[model samples]
Target chain A: MTMKKRNLLLSIIAVIVLFGVANFVQLEMDAYIRRIVNLCMIYAIIGLSMNITNGFVGQFALGQAGFMAVGAYVVGIFTVPVAMRPGVFYATPMNPAIINIYMPLGVALIVGGLLAALIAFVIGTPVLRLRGDYLAIATLGFSEIIRIVITNASSITNGALGIKNIPPLNDVRIIFLATLITFILITLLINSSYGRAFKAIREDEIAAEAMGIDLFYHKNLAFMISAFFAGIGGGLYGALLGTVDPKNFLFTLTYNFLLIIVLGGMGSITGSMLGAVIVTAGLEYLRVFDEPLELFGMAIPLFRPGFRMVMFSVLLMFCVLFWRKGIMGTEEFTWDKFVNFCKHPLAYFTKKGAHAE
Target chain B: MEFFQAFANMTAASFAQHMANGISLGSLYAMIAIGYTMVYGILLMINFAHGDIVMMACYFAFFGITVFHIPWFMTFIGTIIATALLGVVIERAAYRPLRDAPKNSVLISAIGASFLLENLANYLFSGRPMRFPDIPLLSQNIAVGGGVQIQAICFVIPVITIISLVVLLHIVNHTKTGMAMRAVSKDYEIARVMGINIDNVISITFAIGSAMAAIGAIMWGIRYPGITPMLGVMPGLKCFVAAVVGGIGNIKGAVLGGFILGLGEILIVAFFPQLSGYRDAFAFIVLILILYYKPTGLLGETTTEKV
Candidate 1:
């Protein structure tokens, strides 16, 4: 058999095995484990989308939370049962226009993604002109503005009270499927000619412009795509949590995805996937920092409610300072590379050593 | 028609009161913006932790007055010194290593520093809002003519802002150290060739910027009357927008930008009370509009990108 066909077969088998394992975990695992797994998949999607703009397109836009807010709100409004609107919209009556329109989960999620992409398209037109830190601050501003608007638009968004009891899509199978589809789509795009254009822009904007690449169009395209996936992830997030609020989409929430990208290796899809799993599970594991601990028969005073975040922030600083390339460093996992590494571990180490030198 | 009629019927006393409030608020913004502009001018990067530094200064003063029983004046001076030292420390620890690294790496480090400082404060201080000890001279309400009432600190804030501006302007424009600073900002290698200590110049800039943040924080505490760990976030962002609007590298422009933002925020609520819920959105909207129309900002010089 050809190497290409064999690799494809191997990948398909690997995916099937993963799905089988997921089914087993769903049937056997407790609620907490299931929830964490779902979060990992959702965050993986978020990390990948973030990579599209921040990693590939070279724009340091920090508006993921805003896009996620759009997605979550859309999903919350549409997927919630018609009977629950009054209870959810307790402060202000449900807007008459959207009161009766209930959508299935699949349709609602897609609509949410589209709505977020539409918002990105409008905002990106003017904003993508900015370079570097200006772009970052502008995107951050838009995200904050989105949060404030959501807080005030009580009639439509149900304001600060938020929508509750969103029909949970907590099934492992559903999340795995959604994540797989998102992963494949993004990977396909990244390997295409458009992806090359994105990398070119990242390498040098001036040179890219000098060459025949349309900076505005390509940037807007990548931004809208990123927003779309972030929206999907947001929809999944709301469904998993079964609640949606303006507070849930604060600017700090974007920092979670930022940490994931930084830790996983920016510009690498497999890196994002690995980062999502580690970060999500690691955060859960790090809960010990927030709980009282006894060391050497004495209670440590530093272990408290807010200490986990302090450790997390310190880790992020060290990562940026020393390990800026992170785990993957723009390199991806491939069948051939895996095979080569397995065949000669010494060669792999030596190759890496040579590159470092 | 009703809105116009009410506007027309508005008393001069209330108008003057709002004006005073705007100026006082604007002066605070100017102080903070000066820090942002100065740092950006020298380093070509935003000091994301400048706001958090302001937050730390507030905490310093809080501990100084409440815990240590220091007098307000002494605390204020000590806070200034502490904040300046903190700025120098941040520059040396967080920023100095990445001086020649990629711009984005330095930015990420700055963000990391900001998060570290904020989270550290949250861990140490317990995230509770504390009442700022009111200074008798600053907190007392003074009535100006026609029943216009304003805080004495409101007047004091503008005077401080103006005096600081003049002093900063003189130091940047006239002194030997200022000459070295301008040289380093113009070209680091060239300044080093001319025997200027690049590190010292950068450290001095941070010291001045952080001192401004300390002053701004104190004024912010007096005006708002309550202090929290997160208090710096909003003003920090708003003053950043102010710096950008006034032309980031231009010292005088930062003051202008600050007044515009402060007065505009007050007038926005004054004109449309219903829109008060969207108050924080105003600064961002202004930033977007300014960046769109004139990316160099009002007083910023346009520089071309070299391939």
Candidate 2:
């Protein structure tokens, strides 16, 4: 009921949640789980980054996958063993060049973001004027183009063999700590004046333009912000997977983010977070199709494959028809919202009284 | 004289090749673009899942032929029915309720539907690519000029495309259902007041468009002969670009746009392989250029905002 009590309760809850996550994360068995966590953190970063454009700024961009690929390739080329780069791009560095070039992960991530920003800058000037569906399609095309170029630049990208053996940032601690720091920075940024400006554009771009928000500057910034995080996410993914393929950034992969953004609630930070978890976990959990099955009396063989995707699609259809507003319906989970949620979990998840935006 | 001869030969070959490629690709683009334009005309949502639907249609056709061992003609008929039914069902289940929702909500739902389809297909059919069976009927070649070869399928394709276009034109211009579609696209509330069943028009639009996608899928399977759950991804986006480039809500514009995009792709491939890597880039660039120059598209009229 009171602000102080609510703040105290929230702090206690945050500590407990963090503690639980730490304990839970330790339960994973293989190196891949740590990598997946790193990947998810990167996704959270990129999803948050995309939130600036699609979520906060209200521009529908399908280019995040492309941007992430760019970032991944950038980090991959720079950090991969020259011996591994196939010696096609340049004469094998006299020494293993990536080692001497290692920057702090913070700096590298920023560099990745900046590079994405630069790419976004070039693409945005000509493309941002398109509205709604047109804008979305254009961005989608741009991502595909990015993938195409990377795939074709064989001398540089190794012509689809992809850049492999990039130095791994194997510490879960780094990822966990970095993810925490990123969550803080993005949350702060979204609550600041700039975030409000983004929301202004989202609510009504025409009105925002009338309000002198300088649509070009704000949008490019949002795109760059999104691209930057995507780049960082890519760097982490590359580090985790140790192999970077142009195909990895396919439009199909982008669909997952689109699904997450949609399922979470477009234009909502909390929604993006909730979405990333459900989707990433859903991809793995859908392995029931990969497992042995028995329907009725007959022994259905294992890995009837593609079964999960069918179920996923069914779930998606159900969500759209029955839960169109998605999990949060653009509602943010502040302390007050959370307290109310704790009191009425059903209403919170069910989005009771929530209507279409 | 030598320079003139050389220049003339290259220009002729490139231009002819570009034209050939454009017409072929254009016909396919036109097939899917029509679906986009039709849906946008009535629903105002971009049907994000249409690409996957095109893909699903191919698989459906595959199932009809390879799995059912049906005759090719029967496969064609069955696929049309199945895809048309799917179109109507998707509209009713996913989009019908959101008819009046915000544009963004519909867009997301369309995306959900798309994922649902692609993932479903990946589950039912493996992610591994399937070979598209060749049609014995259209398996031949034709020659247009000195030293230039063209597939016989090319000529048959245009004929089928034109016939379909003529039929669609008749349906849109001469039929009563067409009138209801036009009325709904122009204004939903007013159409409801005028006793038009908006749901029926929407379903018809989706069914017709999806049927066209099925035909396109069959043709694409013939030409490329490979099927993947994700196959529709690029074509869907490119065709949407064609629809937008021509005119989002204009049927004729979508057809024309399809040709231009098809030609554009050919020219890019012919002239610049370095840029070939960025082949898909052209669609977005054209979309941006059009949005900047004429957001209403070539044949599209400017939409009026509701007060």
Top TM-score prediction, candidate number: 1
Q: What's the CA error at residue B166 for candidate 1, in Å?
A: 1.0
lDDT of 2 at A219: 85
Docking class of 1: high
DockQ per candidate: 0.85, 0.59
lDDT of 2 by residue, A1-357 (tens): 689787778867885687567546756547657556656666676677777788788888889888889888777777765444544344322234443454544566678778888999999988887667767878888888888888876656665777767777776666666666666777777889888888898888778888888888888888877887788787777777777888799876776677677788877787887888777777777787767777887778645767766776677666666777778877876787767777988886567457532
Candidate 2 residue-wise lDDT at B15: 67
Q: What total of clashing residue pairs does each candidate reach?
A: 0, 9
Clashing pairs in 1: none
Q: lDDT for model 2, please.
A: 0.78
Per-residue lDDT of model 1, residues A140-196, tens digit only: 999999889988988889999999979988699999999999999999999999999
Cα displacement (angstroms), candidate 2, residue A1, comes to 15
- Mark the regions of model 2 whose C-alpha exceeds 4 Å error after superposition: A1-33, A81-104, A294-298, A301-303, A336-357, B1-18, B143-147, B304-307
Name the candidate that leads on DockQ: 1
Model 1 regions more than 4 Å off = B1-6, B145-148
- Give the per-residue lDDT of model 1 (tens digit) for B1-307: 6567557867888888888889999999999999999999889998999999999999998899989999999999999999999999999999999988888888889888988898899989989889988888899999888877799999999999999999999999999999988888778788999899889999999999999999989888888978777788889889999999999988999999999999999877776778889989999999989999988889999988766
